[model samples]
Target: MDATDGRLEAATVRARVATRENIARMNRSERAASALWPVPLAFGLAAILVARVTAVIDSRDALGIRGEFLIRDPDTALQLASVVASGMLVFLGIVFSTTLVAIQLAGSQYSPRAVRIFLRLRLTKVALGVFVATFVFAVAVLGEIRTKSGSDFTPTASLTVLVLLMVATVVTFLVFASGTARLLRIQYLVERIADEARPVFRDAFTRAQEVQADRPAPATATRVCTNRSPGVLDAVDVADLADAAAAAEGWIDVVAPVGGYVATGAPLAVVHGGGGGGGGDDRDGDQDVAIRRCFLLSNERTMLEDPAFGLRQLVDVAIRGLSPAVNDPTTAVQVIDRITDLLGGIADRPDPPEWYVDAAGTARVRMRGDTFDDLLRLGYVEIIRYGAGAPQVVRRLHAAFGSLSALGDARHHASIAAMGALLDAAVADAMPAPFSDLSGHPDPRGLG
Candidate 1:
């Protein structure tokens, strides 16, 4: 009995650790910065190795003839390599400056959260890495050129490699320029955010299906756990929460929903079955710690785990377009189209489950899951509210609802009809007598 109890305790600890690590990975800055470090380190190491190998080869008189290679004279080779290194360093500086400016522009013009899309681009990281690597390799090779016995000795292989790197640097620069230009466009930004959000929606849908099949009875609250700090509830490791709850012979109902700002001392979750031990007992304390470990709180919202974050970003863009200063109804309409595409993808899928169960067939965790109605409201209602005064905006919104209603799914139709009705009432109240007729039906072209 002692050994069995020890093994169970060890397993619980492991589960808790894994849950914490998973939460840490949801941080965008941490993930992007991690990708940046490895590039410079790997390239710096490669530079040293290439320099050493070329020096060894040069010592053995490996070059058949000095003039056979493009760079013949040792002095000229060193001079040219140094120039290339300087140019690459300057180019790298320019790239970093331009990228910073672009990030600033994106943050100011679009939603600040949209900046992560640029930060996470693999192409930009690789471009930065290639230029830095070339510069390092050129400098290393330049250091190895030597003079001995009235003869100049140059490493032909090293110079050749440097020339290739220079060519690669140029190619990468052009590609990076084009990519940066594309990133600035609103269409690309909307599509990219939507693409990233699709998987999150699918995962939530899958989990819901699993929970629905083996639905367990909700447990009555035995204890409530309060948070220690204030932040947005970004994500929760539900599986790990279930593991910990099972170990405590109980279940946890997560009180704070994802994307919600939680304050310190507020009930984050309620433990459902542990014998009323409050916070003092060792077993109860362990359960409290385990439950807290599963909740990932952050100062800002992230798309990694919050299914609604992407929709929020799209809404931000649309609302910004409709602002009085901007007065760009077409931009708002474009955003609605993208939102329509995303909603259409998940329209027919079943809603995610609110409860999580353990291997023992006991319900262990209760979470807030995404529903079609919730998504529809998040994606469209705000835009409708803000753009109600603009006929074009109102018309485009009606068209979006019509498109979704056309799907023929009863669940989707119900939400779409309700939103359309609300939009019609808003337009009637906001638009003047002359334009009230525009709200009669969804015109795909928005009064054009």
Candidate 2:
């Protein structure tokens, strides 16, 4: 391959790796497992090493006068260690079962997406690790106890370590219980989701100086890249797509929006001006594959690439609260408060550029990203539609719009005013009696 071709190939490889890493990082289950599983494994191995070393030292009388620090009876030490290990194993089972039950209950009682918050909790993972580690430590020490005529030995140091582990496990269990209780509160869940989503919104919408204005692709574009798998378009590696387009001397117009689903054979991206070739040709075929790799498809939406997914989660909670089965208007109002904060953050930032340009100042890729208006709609419209009959929900939503409008962005004001009109209409239609009082007025405090 020529130097230019080699450069493009290298760039594509880097892009592919980065894309996979991004997806893995966004996957909550994979992240939790990666972080939580190694704790027990490492602890188990460490326990065995410590046990063997302590056994050797005790047998050799290496401590000499310090032998007084060792537990006097090997048999008693072994029995106690075994009991602690077995008891810890049982406790580990209980903690695991309780955590799973909590997750299941949270999923059923609240939005399923909110369950990710629990999965990502650090305290729970640490508590689990401590329990497993304590059990492993005790078992390892127990194995070192020898009762033979000439081989009787006590792993004094190992026993000491086991005692420490037991204490740590107890403390961790208490903290875990307390944290879980706090997490179960609805207010905590709402705040947690908002906290996680704020930085994502900022990152997704942050303007890049290198991004050029979007240029329309040529009408004669013959090469259309289709998705081979059907799933949500989680993210697009725009830089990689741009590199590939630059290499092929073409521009790629992204057809599918981020967070939207694309079916197999649907147009994922349209490549303009890359000369057409038969399917078997390596040059065109490789370029097609390169472009396809830039679009990361997944079974579900992720906050890493789709800021709207966060809004969707919050909205789901609100809508569920508004449902006839759970008419918790207070919860719905709290959700709106968070939604307003997210929307306000979006309104304050400049729109992220849709077009990516290569170093030569040519636009190589066009991406489909969510706009502030799109977020506004996603954040409020569904909740309003579901809660139209509830005066409290309507009032809170009106106050949210007023707060968003106060940010002084004309576009934001316009979107909020339009939504306010819709809510007014919906409320009038749903509860005609309240229409006279709730009509078109900006209530910053919502009926206070």
lDDT for each of the candidates? 0.76, 0.75
Question: Candidate 1 on 1-448: residue-level lDDT in tens?
Answer: 1245345222121011112237766665545553555666677677778778877776675765445687777888888888998998898898888788888988878778788888777777888888888888888887777755576777787887788988999999999999988988988888888888888777665533252223333356478888877998878887788888777777677898888888987888887776543564334476777788888887777765677988998889888888888787777887888888888777776676566666655566777767889999999888888888888778878888887877646767877889988888888888997787856667776767
Q: Which tens-of-lDDT digit does each residue in 1-448 have in candidate 2?
A: 2245345222221001111234434455444443556655666676667667866776676766323645668788888898898889888887788778778977887888877777777777777777877887787777778877787777666677788887888888888888888888898888988988999898777654543333544546457777778998877777777788888888888999888899987888878877653263334477788887787787766676788888999999998899899888788888888989888887876566666676566777777578898888999898879888877788788788877888747756777789988988888777767464763454544455
Give the number of the best model, judged by lDDT.
1
TM-score of 2: 0.86
List the candidate 1 regions with Cα displacement exceeding 4 Å.
Answer: 1-21, 24-30, 33-38, 53-67, 148-151, 207-221, 276-284
Off by over 4 Å in 2: 1-66, 210-219, 276-284, 432-448
TM-score of each: 0.87, 0.86
